[model samples]
Structures are given as structure tokens and as C-alpha cells.
Target: MMQATQKQDFTTTFSVDRNPREAFEAITNVRGWWSQEVEGVTDQVGGEFDHHYKDVHRCRIRVTELVPGRKVAWLVLDNFFNFIEDQAEWKGTEVVFEISEKDGGAEVRFTHVGLVPQYECYDVCTNAWNGYLGGSLRNLINTGQGQPNPKEGGNAPAHQDAATVLRARRTP
Candidate 1:
């Protein structure tokens, strides 16, 4: 007998003083909170964009669904993570954002479908999302600008090969 696999998407939700429309707009402005190294379009349905985190990670995302002032979803066409055994783990995954009215304000819910805890990059990836969705993205909804990753250089360590990253992860 085969057991069914449990769903383990990573999700984060936050409330903002803004309205649903404002929250929806902020979510579509991916570069404002996701990464400044993004390329191509992001605010329209059927649009495609590429997000890069230096040489560490890169993903091609296509907007698959959009509902004004309500929801948005992106399909991951391709993905590459220099630090993971399965570089394309995020491929075919869906990144979704749901907006609704709550407490006379807006409530935003972000989910990364197919990002199960069983994946090797789950912890690191989810932690990063916590910062992006829960912190940076949330800030963007409240303010005009977001605290995105440094554009050129910052305290981030230089990129390392996959083997090196694996070794570092295993180290005490």
C-alpha cells in the first residue's frame, strides 16, 4: 500500500493598514521587495521575469493568474540554486499571493507551492521568504520603498560551488 504525500507549502501572512487594492499592487511590484536584480516585467498577467540573487540563485517566473485586488500567482518555469543538490527543485512550483479585507485593512497571504520541508533548501529558502514576505514585502505595502537586498555589494559572502555549500551545511 502506498501512502499519500502531505502538502508542505511554505506560507506567510501579514496585515497592513492599506486596502486590498494597495496590497495587490504592492505584491505585483516584485522587484520592490523580492530583489533589485530582477529582469523583465512583473506587474501584468502572462508576463515573465527573472530574479537573480547574485550567483547563488536564479529563477524564471511567469505570471499565471491575476485577480484584481484579490489574488496573484506565478509559475516557476525554471530555477537554479547553486547551493542545492536539486538545482531545479523550484521548477514548476507556484508562488501565490492572496489579498483580502480584514480588520478594516488588508491581509496579505504569500505561499510557495511545492516547497516542501523534505527539500534540502527548505529551511534556508523559507527563512529567506520570511524576511522577504513578512518583513520587506510587508514594509513595501506600508511604505513607498522596500528594504531589498543590496544591488551590487554588501555583507553577503562570495558565491561558492555547490559542493562547498553542501560541505558548509554539514559542518558543525
Candidate 2:
């Protein structure tokens, strides 16, 4: 049997109001803006992280490294959400975020490594990441809290899940 392969890598940059350290901490606080659809506990290096979507799907995330305001990386262990069971797919797969000060504001760069573009979930995952990192992240930095989700009776899609809930699905 031929092995299925999927990989995607991309970097997105955004400006933030807080300092590098402050900005970094907020981004690492995954539970804050990831939506109640996902649950996880991550505070330090080598900590365990989990993403839950109600009872439908759960993804395991492990913090592989942390470097203060400079960088943070996590590897996916199991993705019940995507339903691809290759453990190797999770190996070396990391979501890394970098923070730095630029032009009186913080610059944040989000990178997802080891995600094969061929995977069906690649587009969704990348789009979701962009919304959370670029949208909610910027809001939090400037407003001290994320904007409410429009679908959940708020004014806008401040988080990734909220945006997905509002976006039209494409038939494959």
C-alpha cells in the first residue's frame, strides 16, 4: 500500500501593541482565543496541549520548545479532528510562533511546519490559523480582549472557529 503524505508550511506576520514578551505570552495562551470548541492546558515548556471540538474531535499538542518572547513550538500527537492516524505525521510537525519588537510595536510571525499541502485539512487549518493569529491576536493586543464571535451573537469573527462557522463550505 502506498503511504499518504500531507505537508504545509507558511508564515504570517502581524503587528501588535504589546511588547515582545507580553505579546508572546498572549499567543501561547491557546485557551484564550482558540474558541471553546477546543480545550488545552499549556503554560510552560514540554507541557501537554489538547484541542477539543465538543465530542466530535480532539487534537493532541505537545510543546516541544519555548524561548520566552522569541519562540514557541508544539507538535501534534493525534488529530481526531482531521482523522489521519499516521503518528509520523505528527512527528516533527510543529506550530511555531515568533515575537519581536518592530517600529514601536511587536511583530508576530506564525509558522506551521510539516503540514503537507496535499492533505484535505491543510487549507482549513491554514485559514483557521490566519484568522486567529492575525485577527483575534491583533484585537487582543489593541483592545485587551478579542472581539465577540458574530455567529455567537457578537459583531465579528474574532477567532478561527468563529470565522469557519461563518464561512461557506466548498464541495470537493
lDDT for each candidate structure: 0.81, 0.64
TM-score of each: 0.87, 0.73
Top candidate when judged by lDDT against the true structure: 1
Candidate 1 regions exceeding 4 Å error are 1-5, 154-167, 170-172
Sequence-dependent TM-score of model 1: 0.87
Best TM-score goes to which candidate? 1
Tens digit per residue, CA lDDT, model 2, 1-172: 1122343366678988788888877777675556544445676777887676543246788887787888777887766543333435444567778778888878988777776576555665677677777777677766667542323333335334532443334323
Ten consecutive residues with minimal summed lDDT in candidate 2?
147-156
lDDT of 1: 0.81
